[model samples]
Target: MLYLTIDETNTLIREARTDAFHLEVSDDHSAVADETEPMRRVLAGLPPFEAGAYPDSWREWDELVSELTNRGVTMRRVRVVSEPLTDYLRFLHGLTDRNARLGEDIRWLPRHLVDQADYTTDEWWLIDNAEVAFTIFGTDGDFVGAALTEDPTIVDRCVRVRDALWSKATPHAVYSPSGWSG
Candidate 1:
């Protein structure tokens, strides 16, 4: 169970050979402080800009995803969200189309559809089916560090869970976050 900094986790994702799968179960992740302005704009009913004109933060991620896609590394994410979307999730929803266009396969699963006890509460990244990096968050959902493991037991279990959730989630292109009243 080795601990990793955010940079280290990003490095792991960048180095993935075949696939990078992420599972996010939190409704609000305080780690995304950089997105505050963008989120505020979204919640305020502002329209998004052209992808080429997006903010630097978003462009940086787009570049990474494009690079990975060029390298033939498949990237996928499944977010388990509660209804009446939180501002954070709504922000993410606003950005999902761009993310999908950048080569990430993003999906959303409504919380009501799954048993809470069936999944791990932590967010995690499974790199190439070999390593599982579980994100540690503070009680307030602030970013802590990450626990990374290559232990087959942990990695295999995460793979199973990811697959199960992925199969059940709706693809981002078709899923509307209609629950967001704001």
Candidate 2:
């Protein structure tokens, strides 16, 4: 097993012409406000590619989605959350610009969190597919962080989560919103 530190991995990705980077968020690192800037620079160096996110809180801002669209990357969102309401889901949809939507290639899936508390089985799966996970540690480093992983299990879990949600989610192409005819 090869191991690359965060800085090393960042440098490698920042220099590459193209690559897919998946990020998994936890409350600890989710507080960073905006991770999109660094990701934009990192993505700019890459060829056309994909990126996935399991965003938490403000991490699901429209700005980040817009940034991803501007970067010419395909982004898929699999919401493996167990919340009482789906305010975030609606917010994401609203953030999507119709003009950019066709080019941005952004999709969201709302998953059924059957058993988990704050996370789902699929969320853990994303952690596994990350090539190099980034975890921002607090001054004390008390398990306060985020990370990316390249483990097969993690990747598999995310796929499963996406599939499950996709199957259950309303097909946007078929279901038109208010005032729009399909």
Candidate 3:
């Protein structure tokens, strides 16, 4: 089995979008940049993001925002913040006023942290597509990389960990109130 810390997950997510997609993110606030952010530094590419979620940030740039304009990407946001998610939702709406297309490509998945129990459609979907799985450490953790196989034993183990979080996770319905409040 291989493990991917936050950095690696960021890399893959940047690479995985071709059409509509799903992403199950953990409850960590360490912001990371995938290709979109770096690519944006030079030019505007890709239009419309698929489905995904993230906390709100006051930071100047957000990969989610950049990805939305990408017709190639369809973004769904689940802001795991300490404040009422409705507030974040409102903020997103505000952004739409400025850029109508902002609302066009992005959707707000039921905002919730990945649980340690059951898996969401998004989680299972992500795993199914993963020819390889990377275990991303949440805090002070390093990258552990392992290739996934169709083998029952390996797949079972991966399913166990993924399910653990998936079960305990709150659907984009619960608010954590710390990560994104801006």
Candidate 4:
């Protein structure tokens, strides 16, 4: 199933969510170019973060993670990146601790540190360790939607790949894009 809009994709993700939801994020500078954040800030009347004040009030993020984690749902993610980190990645770094505090375990793996052949290059979600949703991005780095599937083989492969990457990736707290090592 292909979700053509963000709302449709969000709905599918929320509905399909189970006890444990894992994510693998490997993207370009999508977040910085994303239209949602600016609109979200406007709706909340929040000022643009200078360095993204950590523990900053992103109500939706706080509420969702708070709700899910309180319900004992496990959320974890591994992000693979090519260094030097993109501007969006550097920006995202400041907000990750908020996620860690909310019970999500996020790890970062410099692309040079991993075997390129072992993992998928694009961003994806392995929901409940049961389904695979491959994100589609436009040339401008805006998210278009996703190709979602529940094929057993695809699910199995994602699980395996996620495991391999998650094991080697550095925890977000310990990884500094500026301090990347070969």
Write model 2 residue lDDT over 92-181, tens digit each, in one string.
333444423533333333334233333342222122234433444556533233455666775565555445554554433443343322
Model 2 scores a TM of 0.39
Give lDDT: candidate 4, residue 146: 79
Candidate 2 vs candidate 3: which has greater lDDT? 2
Runs of candidate 4 exceeding 4 Å displacement: 16-27, 30-58, 178-182
What are the per-model numbers of colliding residue pairs? 0, 11, 45, 0
Candidate 4: residue pairs that collide: none
lDDT of 1 by residue, 1-182 (tens): 99998778778888999999999998987356566666777778886553455677566678889999889999999999998788789888887888888889999999888765457777899999999999877676556668999999889888888888888899988887764543
Against the correct fold, how does model 1 do in TM-score? Answer: 0.87
lDDT of each: 0.83, 0.38, 0.38, 0.67
| Selected candidate, larger TM-score, 3 vs 4 | 4
lDDT-superior candidate, 3 or 4? 4
Model 3 lDDT tens row, 1-182: 44554445445545645422333343332233332332233223332232342223312224543553364554333222223434324333334333334432322333444443544332322334334343443343323332323456645655555435434434433423344443
TM, every model: 0.87, 0.39, 0.33, 0.75
The Cα RMSD in angstroms, rounded to one decimal, for candidate 3 relative to the true structure is 10.7
Model 2 bad stretches (over 4 Å) = 1-73, 80-89, 98-102, 106-145, 171-182
lDDT tens readout by residue for model 4, 1-182: 65546655655555545643455455445443443464345335454343554343365556667676777776778888777876456545656786889877889888888876568766777778777778787776666777888899988888888888888999987887855331
RMSD of 1: 2.7
Worst 10 residues of 1 by lDDT: 48-57
